[model samples]
Target: MLVALIALITTVLYFVGGALLMQRLKLTAAGEPPGSRGLPRLFTLWGAAIVLHAFVLYAFLFGENADSLGVFTVVSLTAWVIAAFLFAWSFRHPIHVLGIVLLPFAGVTVALDMALSGVGPATPMDPSLRAHTLLALIAFSLFTIAAIQAAVLAIQTHMLQNHRPGGLIRALPPLSLMDTLLFHIIGWGFIFLTAALATGLFVLEDIFAQHLLQKVVFALIAWVMFAVLLFGRFQFGWRGRKAAHWTLAGFVWLFIAYIGSRMILARLLGV
Candidate 1:
């Protein structure tokens, strides 16, 4: 019941905040709006969901059941803080479009958190573990933003190659901006992924033969992909469609790494 209520509220926030966030990002005929209206109110719903989930965190932590699933809550909260900060920072620049992508992503995460935050040994945070976890998660999150940028870049590059523009393409940030953001995100994601893996190896009892091992495999594959793309970008000067394609590929590996783990853990094991 608690999970249902949280999901329902977050779902509403997604719709309401997502729709209004779009309007708040309304571009003018001249250019992007004012360049500084600040974050849209709809985004507040996302924060509210994050804050609300803290109750769940506390409950599971202190509740008689002491569900191990509290780890999901921690993960969800970690993502929320990172996304919120990223969105807030990006908004100060020309990355308002990111809000549209991130808010919906976060909404889905909230729902997932609710579903999963019901099992596990309830590993409470220790200083070193928390530090490693936060760094890894923030790095992983950058890949998410990179994924969104990749999608936007692909669409823009397509329109450019075909010599068509306007509509959603117009709504996109400049292609160069998108590309720059992609590389930037990939760079951060790679670095963070490295840290996350390192931390996981230290924190876990067994690194291999578990779901975490699978996640590490996929993540390493993603890191390699990102590394190759980065090399290509700098050395071979891969740009336009090739860059977009590589970005998408790398982000796909990243998606499988974490989301796949969540799916197996939550759906199959009921954790």
Candidate 2:
């Protein structure tokens, strides 16, 4: 009961934060700087909500008799990590443009986690497996941020290219900064993903034999796509729309590799 209450409160805060961001963006015209006055209070609310959410999640995931890690738990944890990172990074970087979309999505995931609970089998808490899982979650969180950055970059590019920069573009970081952030995010995500894959292949060798071959294959593909993007960024000076498109494309493969494959194996195939 307490857990549900916390989740509900967190969900409300996330939605409210997202709505506030959207309104703030809407209020800023194409040529005007984004409003910053309301951000401190908003960040405080998010910090409080995330702290509660993290506490609830830690209790649920590591409680007595919590031997199995379920799909819903994984999804919830992934979103939680992303939200936590976003909140922390907001202090150093002006990446709040992502909150307009990410916060509401986080709210939805929290609600779903509370409502549906877990539908799939839970994996036992093996130490090596836990390490692998942590790496995977961290990698996914980084990639998720990169994906959001890519999306915003795409929008910013289009608005500038078409000279239709009256709404969102005004509120976004400059294009060069957005592009730089995207690559840096992708670079870090790639490193984490590489570690995740290494751990999966070496520590969790049985996963491939146990119906996760598709996930591994797609993950490799996503890794390769990111590699190419990074190489192009450094070697060929890729930027603007091209970089955005490739970043999104790499994210697509990753989405398929992780979440899509999980949905198939657990929900559809019932394996």
Point to the candidate with the largest TM-score. 2
Off by over 4 Å in 2: 30-34
lDDT of 1: 0.68
lDDT to native, each model: 0.68, 0.84
Instruction: Please give the lDDT score at residue 132 for candidate 2.
Output: 85
Q: Which lDDT tens digits does candidate 1 get at residues 51-72?
A: 6655544555456654333556
Candidate 2 per-residue lDDT over residues 150-181, each given as its tens digit: 88888889889998876777777788888888
**Model 2 whole-model lDDT (C-alpha atoms):** 0.84
Runs in model 1 deviating more than 4 A are 1-11, 24-75, 119-128, 209-211, 269-271
Evaluate residue 124 in candidate 1 and report its C-alpha lDDT on the 0 to 100 scale. Answer: 46
Candidate 2 deviation (Cα RMSD):
1.5
